[model samples]
Target: MSGEWQHGLLGCFDNFTLCLISWLVPCYQFGKNAEAVGESCLICGLGFLVPVVDIFLAIHIRGKIRESKGIQGSLIGDLLYWCFCPLCSLVQEAQEVGGAPQAISMGRE
Candidate 1:
Protein backbone atom coordinates (compact mmCIF):
# COMPACT_ATOMS: atom_id res chain seq x y z
CA MET A 1 0.00 0.00 0.00
CA SER A 2 1.13 3.50 -0.76
CA GLY A 3 1.70 6.06 1.93
CA GLU A 4 -0.68 8.56 0.41
CA TRP A 5 -4.14 8.94 -1.02
CA GLN A 6 -4.58 7.06 -4.31
CA HIS A 7 -6.34 10.06 -5.86
CA GLY A 8 -6.30 13.73 -5.20
CA LEU A 9 -9.45 15.48 -4.04
CA LEU A 10 -10.20 16.89 -7.48
CA GLY A 11 -9.31 13.57 -9.06
CA CYS A 12 -12.57 11.99 -7.89
CA PHE A 13 -13.92 12.61 -11.37
CA ASP A 14 -11.46 10.05 -12.69
CA ASN A 15 -13.70 7.38 -11.19
CA PHE A 16 -17.18 8.57 -11.95
CA THR A 17 -18.97 5.66 -10.34
CA LEU A 18 -17.17 6.09 -7.04
CA CYS A 19 -17.59 9.84 -7.21
CA LEU A 20 -21.32 9.47 -7.73
CA ILE A 21 -21.62 6.93 -4.94
CA SER A 22 -19.73 9.19 -2.56
CA TRP A 23 -21.80 12.18 -3.53
CA LEU A 24 -25.19 10.51 -3.39
CA VAL A 25 -24.61 8.37 -0.29
CA PRO A 26 -21.71 9.66 1.76
CA CYS A 27 -22.65 7.60 4.82
CA TYR A 28 -22.59 4.42 2.78
CA GLN A 29 -19.15 5.31 1.51
CA PHE A 30 -18.03 6.05 5.03
CA GLY A 31 -19.29 2.69 6.20
CA LYS A 32 -17.44 0.96 3.40
CA ASN A 33 -14.28 2.80 4.29
CA ALA A 34 -14.68 1.83 7.93
CA GLU A 35 -15.09 -1.79 6.99
CA ALA A 36 -12.02 -1.71 4.78
CA VAL A 37 -9.89 -0.50 7.67
CA GLY A 38 -11.20 -3.14 10.09
CA GLU A 39 -13.55 -0.83 11.95
CA SER A 40 -17.18 -1.12 12.87
CA CYS A 41 -19.32 -0.11 9.91
CA LEU A 42 -22.47 -0.08 12.00
CA ILE A 43 -20.96 2.43 14.40
CA CYS A 44 -19.71 4.57 11.55
CA GLY A 45 -23.09 4.47 9.84
CA LEU A 46 -24.81 5.50 13.02
CA GLY A 47 -22.25 8.20 13.70
CA PHE A 48 -23.06 9.86 10.41
CA LEU A 49 -26.39 10.97 11.87
CA VAL A 50 -24.60 13.24 14.31
CA PRO A 51 -23.00 16.19 12.58
CA VAL A 52 -19.99 17.00 14.76
CA VAL A 53 -19.26 13.49 15.88
CA ASP A 54 -19.44 12.20 12.35
CA ILE A 55 -16.62 14.44 11.22
CA PHE A 56 -14.42 13.34 14.10
CA LEU A 57 -15.25 9.71 13.53
CA ALA A 58 -14.51 10.04 9.85
CA ILE A 59 -11.13 11.53 10.68
CA HIS A 60 -10.46 8.72 13.10
CA ILE A 61 -11.37 6.16 10.52
CA ARG A 62 -9.13 7.83 7.97
CA GLY A 63 -6.29 7.81 10.46
CA LYS A 64 -6.82 4.15 11.14
CA ILE A 65 -6.79 3.43 7.42
CA ARG A 66 -3.59 5.36 6.97
CA GLU A 67 -1.98 3.57 9.88
CA SER A 68 -3.07 0.12 8.76
CA LYS A 69 -2.09 0.70 5.17
CA GLY A 70 1.09 2.64 6.00
CA ILE A 71 -0.24 5.77 4.32
CA GLN A 72 1.61 8.89 5.30
CA GLY A 73 -0.58 11.79 6.45
CA SER A 74 -1.08 14.24 9.22
CA LEU A 75 -4.00 15.18 11.41
CA ILE A 76 -4.28 18.53 9.65
CA GLY A 77 -4.54 16.80 6.32
CA ASP A 78 -7.17 14.40 7.61
CA LEU A 79 -9.12 17.29 9.13
CA LEU A 80 -9.08 19.20 5.88
CA TYR A 81 -10.30 16.25 3.85
CA TRP A 82 -12.96 15.21 6.33
CA CYS A 83 -14.20 18.73 6.77
CA PHE A 84 -14.10 20.27 3.31
CA CYS A 85 -14.20 17.33 0.92
CA PRO A 86 -15.46 14.23 2.59
CA LEU A 87 -16.82 12.62 -0.57
CA CYS A 88 -13.49 12.88 -2.32
CA SER A 89 -11.76 11.48 0.72
CA LEU A 90 -14.13 8.54 0.83
CA VAL A 91 -13.65 7.83 -2.86
CA GLN A 92 -9.90 7.91 -2.44
CA GLU A 93 -10.10 5.55 0.52
CA ALA A 94 -12.26 3.14 -1.45
CA GLN A 95 -9.81 3.18 -4.32
CA GLU A 96 -6.87 2.48 -2.05
CA VAL A 97 -8.42 -0.38 -0.12
CA GLY A 98 -10.37 -1.91 -3.00
CA GLY A 99 -7.23 -2.12 -5.15
CA ALA A 100 -6.64 -0.64 -8.59
CA PRO A 101 -9.51 -0.22 -10.99
CA GLN A 102 -8.41 -3.17 -13.10
CA ALA A 103 -7.98 -5.36 -10.05
CA ILE A 104 -11.46 -4.54 -8.86
CA SER A 105 -12.91 -5.28 -12.29
CA MET A 106 -11.12 -8.60 -12.48
CA GLY A 107 -12.56 -9.70 -9.16
CA ARG A 108 -16.07 -9.62 -10.60
CA GLU A 109 -15.18 -12.13 -13.29
Candidate 2:
Protein backbone atom coordinates (compact mmCIF):
# COMPACT_ATOMS: atom_id res chain seq x y z
CA MET A 1 0.00 0.00 0.00
CA SER A 2 2.73 2.43 0.93
CA GLY A 3 4.62 1.51 -2.20
CA GLU A 4 1.59 2.22 -4.30
CA TRP A 5 1.24 5.64 -2.72
CA GLN A 6 4.87 6.44 -3.50
CA HIS A 7 4.42 5.38 -7.11
CA GLY A 8 1.38 7.57 -7.46
CA LEU A 9 3.33 10.52 -6.10
CA LEU A 10 6.09 9.99 -8.62
CA GLY A 11 3.60 9.67 -11.45
CA CYS A 12 2.09 13.02 -10.51
CA PHE A 13 5.52 14.61 -10.56
CA ASP A 14 6.16 13.20 -14.00
CA ASN A 15 2.94 14.75 -15.25
CA PHE A 16 3.94 18.10 -13.79
CA THR A 17 7.13 18.20 -15.80
CA LEU A 18 5.19 17.07 -18.84
CA CYS A 19 2.83 20.01 -18.45
CA LEU A 20 5.63 22.49 -17.94
CA ILE A 21 7.58 21.38 -20.98
CA SER A 22 4.52 21.14 -23.19
CA TRP A 23 3.23 24.52 -22.04
CA LEU A 24 6.58 26.28 -22.35
CA VAL A 25 7.77 24.84 -25.66
CA PRO A 26 4.90 26.09 -27.80
CA CYS A 27 4.78 29.38 -25.93
CA TYR A 28 8.45 29.96 -26.61
CA GLN A 29 8.23 28.66 -30.16
CA PHE A 30 5.30 30.84 -31.21
CA GLY A 31 6.07 34.02 -29.24
CA LYS A 32 2.42 34.57 -28.53
CA ASN A 33 1.01 37.78 -27.11
CA ALA A 34 2.00 38.35 -23.49
CA GLU A 35 -1.39 38.43 -21.83
CA ALA A 36 -2.79 35.39 -23.60
CA VAL A 37 0.41 33.42 -23.16
CA GLY A 38 0.51 34.02 -19.42
CA GLU A 39 -3.10 33.04 -19.08
CA SER A 40 -2.65 29.91 -21.12
CA CYS A 41 0.34 28.77 -19.07
CA LEU A 42 -1.62 29.13 -15.84
CA ILE A 43 -4.57 27.28 -17.26
CA CYS A 44 -2.52 24.42 -18.67
CA GLY A 45 -0.65 24.03 -15.41
CA LEU A 46 -3.85 23.48 -13.46
CA GLY A 47 -5.10 20.76 -15.78
CA PHE A 48 -1.84 18.90 -16.24
CA LEU A 49 -0.71 18.72 -12.63
CA VAL A 50 -4.07 17.88 -11.12
CA PRO A 51 -4.62 14.72 -13.17
CA VAL A 52 -8.14 15.99 -13.61
CA VAL A 53 -7.55 15.91 -17.39
CA ASP A 54 -9.25 19.29 -17.89
CA ILE A 55 -12.37 18.07 -19.66
CA PHE A 56 -14.27 20.64 -21.72
CA LEU A 57 -13.86 23.39 -19.18
CA ALA A 58 -15.67 26.32 -20.72
CA ILE A 59 -16.30 28.55 -17.75
CA HIS A 60 -12.93 28.74 -16.03
CA ILE A 61 -10.94 30.33 -18.83
CA ARG A 62 -14.10 32.35 -19.48
CA GLY A 63 -13.80 31.55 -23.16
CA LYS A 64 -14.81 28.74 -25.44
CA ILE A 65 -11.88 26.36 -25.36
CA ARG A 66 -10.10 25.80 -28.62
CA GLU A 67 -9.84 22.19 -27.47
CA SER A 68 -10.77 20.89 -24.04
CA LYS A 69 -9.13 17.52 -23.45
CA GLY A 70 -5.64 17.60 -21.96
CA ILE A 71 -2.51 15.60 -22.73
CA GLN A 72 -3.44 12.40 -20.87
CA GLY A 73 -7.04 12.92 -21.83
CA SER A 74 -6.04 12.69 -25.49
CA LEU A 75 -4.98 9.58 -27.36
CA ILE A 76 -1.26 10.30 -27.23
CA GLY A 77 -1.26 11.49 -23.64
CA ASP A 78 -3.35 8.50 -22.69
CA LEU A 79 -0.49 6.40 -24.02
CA LEU A 80 1.58 7.68 -21.05
CA TYR A 81 4.00 9.60 -23.25
CA TRP A 82 3.46 13.31 -22.68
CA CYS A 83 6.34 15.27 -24.26
CA PHE A 84 9.57 13.95 -22.83
CA CYS A 85 9.65 11.29 -25.48
CA PRO A 86 9.50 13.95 -28.17
CA LEU A 87 12.18 15.96 -26.40
CA CYS A 88 14.33 12.85 -26.32
CA SER A 89 13.62 12.33 -30.00
CA LEU A 90 14.70 15.89 -30.69
CA VAL A 91 17.94 15.29 -28.83
CA GLN A 92 18.47 12.10 -30.74
CA GLU A 93 17.92 13.99 -33.98
CA ALA A 94 20.44 16.59 -32.94
CA GLN A 95 22.99 13.90 -32.13
CA GLU A 96 22.37 12.35 -35.51
CA VAL A 97 22.80 15.67 -37.26
CA GLY A 98 26.47 16.28 -36.50
CA GLY A 99 25.79 16.92 -32.83
CA ALA A 100 27.80 13.96 -31.57
CA PRO A 101 31.49 14.34 -30.57
CA GLN A 102 30.98 18.11 -30.41
CA ALA A 103 34.15 19.72 -29.19
CA ILE A 104 34.15 23.30 -27.94
CA SER A 105 37.36 25.16 -28.49
CA MET A 106 37.66 28.16 -26.21
CA GLY A 107 39.17 31.29 -27.74
CA ARG A 108 40.62 34.27 -25.90
CA GLU A 109 37.70 36.54 -24.99
Candidate 3:
Protein backbone atom coordinates (compact mmCIF):
# COMPACT_ATOMS: atom_id res chain seq x y z
CA MET A 1 0.00 0.00 0.00
CA SER A 2 1.02 3.61 -0.48
CA GLY A 3 2.46 5.66 2.37
CA GLU A 4 -0.79 7.56 2.76
CA TRP A 5 -2.69 4.30 2.92
CA GLN A 6 -0.28 2.96 5.47
CA HIS A 7 -0.63 6.16 7.49
CA GLY A 8 -4.40 5.88 7.50
CA LEU A 9 -4.46 2.11 8.10
CA LEU A 10 -1.89 2.05 10.83
CA GLY A 11 -3.05 5.41 12.00
CA CYS A 12 -6.54 4.11 12.80
CA PHE A 13 -5.12 1.12 14.61
CA ASP A 14 -2.83 3.40 16.55
CA ASN A 15 -5.76 5.65 17.33
CA PHE A 16 -7.79 2.74 18.67
CA THR A 17 -4.83 1.63 20.72
CA LEU A 18 -4.41 5.07 22.22
CA CYS A 19 -8.09 5.42 23.08
CA LEU A 20 -8.07 2.07 24.84
CA ILE A 21 -4.95 2.93 26.75
CA SER A 22 -6.32 6.30 27.81
CA TRP A 23 -9.65 4.83 28.93
CA LEU A 24 -7.84 2.29 31.05
CA VAL A 25 -5.05 4.63 32.12
CA PRO A 26 -6.71 5.69 35.37
CA CYS A 27 -5.37 2.36 36.75
CA TYR A 28 -7.91 2.17 39.58
CA GLN A 29 -10.69 1.27 37.15
CA PHE A 30 -8.93 -1.97 36.27
CA GLY A 31 -8.60 -2.90 39.93
CA LYS A 32 -10.29 -6.28 39.70
CA ASN A 33 -8.52 -7.23 36.51
CA ALA A 34 -5.06 -6.14 37.61
CA GLU A 35 -4.10 -9.78 37.65
CA ALA A 36 -4.69 -9.91 33.91
CA VAL A 37 -3.68 -6.50 32.67
CA GLY A 38 -3.05 -8.00 29.27
CA GLU A 39 -6.62 -9.16 28.88
CA SER A 40 -7.93 -5.90 30.28
CA CYS A 41 -5.87 -4.09 27.72
CA LEU A 42 -7.42 -6.15 24.99
CA ILE A 43 -10.97 -5.52 26.21
CA CYS A 44 -10.61 -1.78 26.62
CA GLY A 45 -8.58 -1.73 23.45
CA LEU A 46 -11.29 -3.59 21.55
CA GLY A 47 -13.89 -1.05 22.59
CA PHE A 48 -12.33 1.48 20.22
CA LEU A 49 -12.60 -0.92 17.30
CA VAL A 50 -16.31 -0.31 17.06
CA PRO A 51 -17.48 2.48 14.72
CA VAL A 52 -19.16 5.50 16.35
CA VAL A 53 -18.13 4.61 19.87
CA ASP A 54 -14.49 4.70 18.92
CA ILE A 55 -14.80 8.09 17.27
CA PHE A 56 -16.38 9.61 20.35
CA LEU A 57 -13.73 7.88 22.42
CA ALA A 58 -11.05 9.55 20.38
CA ILE A 59 -12.75 12.88 20.96
CA HIS A 60 -12.96 12.13 24.65
CA ILE A 61 -9.21 11.80 24.86
CA ARG A 62 -8.52 14.71 22.55
CA GLY A 63 -7.78 17.11 25.39
CA LYS A 64 -5.10 14.82 26.68
CA ILE A 65 -3.44 14.82 23.28
CA ARG A 66 -1.70 18.12 23.94
CA GLU A 67 -0.76 17.33 27.52
CA SER A 68 0.76 13.95 26.62
CA LYS A 69 3.14 15.42 24.10
CA GLY A 70 3.18 14.66 20.38
CA ILE A 71 1.12 11.88 18.85
CA GLN A 72 1.76 8.31 20.01
CA GLY A 73 2.00 7.56 23.69
CA SER A 74 -1.25 9.18 24.83
CA LEU A 75 -2.31 10.99 21.68
CA ILE A 76 -1.82 8.55 18.84
CA GLY A 77 -5.41 7.37 18.99
CA ASP A 78 -6.78 10.89 18.88
CA LEU A 79 -4.62 11.79 15.89
CA LEU A 80 -5.57 8.62 14.09
CA TYR A 81 -9.18 9.76 14.12
CA TRP A 82 -8.12 12.65 11.92
CA CYS A 83 -7.20 10.04 9.33
CA PHE A 84 -10.44 8.09 9.68
CA CYS A 85 -14.14 9.01 9.92
CA PRO A 86 -14.61 12.29 8.13
CA LEU A 87 -18.36 11.97 7.51
CA CYS A 88 -19.09 11.61 11.20
CA SER A 89 -16.84 14.56 11.93
CA LEU A 90 -18.61 16.74 9.41
CA VAL A 91 -22.03 15.85 10.73
CA GLN A 92 -20.88 16.50 14.26
CA GLU A 93 -19.55 19.88 13.26
CA ALA A 94 -22.76 20.72 11.44
CA GLN A 95 -24.90 19.69 14.38
CA GLU A 96 -22.80 21.60 16.86
CA VAL A 97 -22.71 24.72 14.71
CA GLY A 98 -26.08 24.47 13.00
CA GLY A 99 -27.87 23.34 16.19
CA ALA A 100 -29.72 20.56 14.36
CA PRO A 101 -29.21 18.43 11.31
CA GLN A 102 -31.75 19.12 8.64
CA ALA A 103 -32.08 16.19 6.31
CA ILE A 104 -31.67 17.18 2.71
CA SER A 105 -33.30 14.54 0.63
CA MET A 106 -32.45 14.17 -3.01
CA GLY A 107 -36.14 13.50 -3.70
CA ARG A 108 -36.97 16.96 -2.43
CA GLU A 109 -34.73 18.47 -5.08
lDDT of 2 by residue, 68-102 (tens): 21211234332332233433322222222222223
Q: How far off is residue 36 in model 1, in Å?
A: 0.8
- What would the per-residue lDDT of candidate 1 be over residues 18-68, giving only the tens digit for each residue? 777778887877887888888888889789779899989878988888888
TM-score, candidate number 1? 0.82
Q: Which candidate has the highest TM-score of all?
A: 1
Candidate 3 lDDT over 4-108, as tens digits, reads 221332232334433343244423222112212222434433544666654554454332322332333334544554347533332222222221323468784
Q: What is the lDDT of residue 78 in candidate 2?
A: 21
Model 2 ranges off by over 4 Å: 1-39, 52-80, 83-109
Alpha-carbon shift of residue 83 in model 2 (angstroms): 8.8
Number of the top-ranking candidate, with lDDT as the measure: 1
Backbone clash total for model 2 is: 0
lDDT of 3: 0.34
**Which model is ahead, 1 or 2, in terms of TM-score?**
1
Least accurate stretch of 10 residues (summed lDDT) in model 2?
62-71
Error of 3 at 38 (Å): 14
